[model samples]
Target: MLQGMRLTADKEHIAVVLNRPKYAGNIGSAARCAKNMGVERLMVVSDRDYPQEEIRQMSTHLAADVVDSIVYCRDLGEALSGFHYVVGTTARLGLARGPVMSPRDMAEQVVELSRKNDVALLFGPEDTGLTNEDLRYCQSVVSIPTSERFRSLNLSHAVMILCYEISMAEIGVPERFTPKMASSRETEGMYGHIGALLQEIGFLNPENPEYWMMHIRRLFSRMRLSAREVRIIRGICRQLSWYLHHRG
Candidate 1:
């Protein structure tokens, strides 16, 4: 009778992460928003201390569970370390943000993605938003469109928008099994291997290798590498390293 639950199970597979949030009230509000959309996992990446009473007051009783269960991390990388797919949200965009997707569009992808992989929807701080350096771990990014006259959005408002779209996605029904992507740990290890190998081969400039590696990251992000694929790439890097050492 309740077949129209609209994929409530997807909630378990997705985590809403706040990066370096400045306000405890906003964190609480974000938790309430996440709970409203059935998004259960809440993680906060911050070093600052926020009053627990203020947070619980803002969260209220409805989302007390979420606020109480929040996971704390020192940084974004550590916060999303266990996730397989990471999506970052930003108000400012340029070459560093990489290709951007609309919230609705990204939510559509999330429905399928969350079915097979642990997905992280990352949001930045209240003022500056996500920095270019912070986006290194994200596979892709989504930017919410607002009036050109005033572009910035409230932190909790942004969280509500993303969670709302994910909750209401039309393609929420499971059609097929999606292959799981590699976890952040696996992918980051693979990227590290590739970066060092490219540096050794002089394919990436030694002076500023990250500039070149950024492009490589985007290229591979599109490939949606699985754990097996990551292993294969790392294996290739190992073989290449051996050849370079032995051929001499």
Candidate 2:
């Protein structure tokens, strides 16, 4: 910890979201890591109820509060819907993954965002990292650079690295005001409307809207659109729909 450096991001607003994690121990270890770094929220997205004792055993007393307050969510949307910004963690990359950020760089950005917004660090299952569908919900993706020999990292280790970088990030008083961006729920709604409108105009394949939409998501994710901006885009989409309908 840097001496006299104030931790800027609100711990209450920062969350570690586990998407379909398979191991109880990993969840516990993640809880431990989050607590260690002053993050207090943990959300698990899965239907199955993991073993509490096993979870607590690994988390121990240090993170017992994290485990105790863990919010169990049914799916990805419910897990992420309330978040103003979500960062997905992945080991693999492709054109579909969109632009990737290193953990340190992401932490720097997130520290600022968390001062006024809700942010989620989404980690995938231990077997496979977040899928393309999961990445769709994320505004940004982070990949930890590893040797070519082994690109993967243990799930808990990934959480620890992200949390540590974020916690240790030293910042002077920010000159610019960081506004609250659109929530995942609101952003998804905007995408849905835009997708329908694009297909209506024959710009996207009606049979394969998602393929084209991935590119669109990348374009807008970079914008970090606020609720007002999202509404503006959707409002234009609505007007376009009306104009198209009235065209003779």
Give me the overall lDDT of model 2. Answer: 0.90
Give all candidate RMSDs, comma-separated.
2.6, 2.7
lDDT of 1 by residue, 1-248 (tens): 24444653377999999999898999999999899999978999988888998899888899999988999988777788799989999988788778899999998888878878999999988999988888889998999999999997999899999999988885645655579999998999999999989988989988888998899899998888999999999999999999998995
Candidate 2, 6-53: lDDT as tens digits: 546676789999999999999999999888889889999999989999
Model 1 / residue 190 / CA error / Å? 0.4
Model 2 reaches what TM-score against the true structure?
0.94
Please state the error at residue 42 of candidate 1 in Å: 0.6
Whole-structure CA lDDT of model 1: 0.89
Measured by C-alpha RMSD in angstroms, how accurate is candidate 1? 2.6
Q: Estimate each model's TM-score.
A: 0.94, 0.94
lDDT of each: 0.89, 0.90
Q: List the residue pairs that clash in candidate 1.
A: none
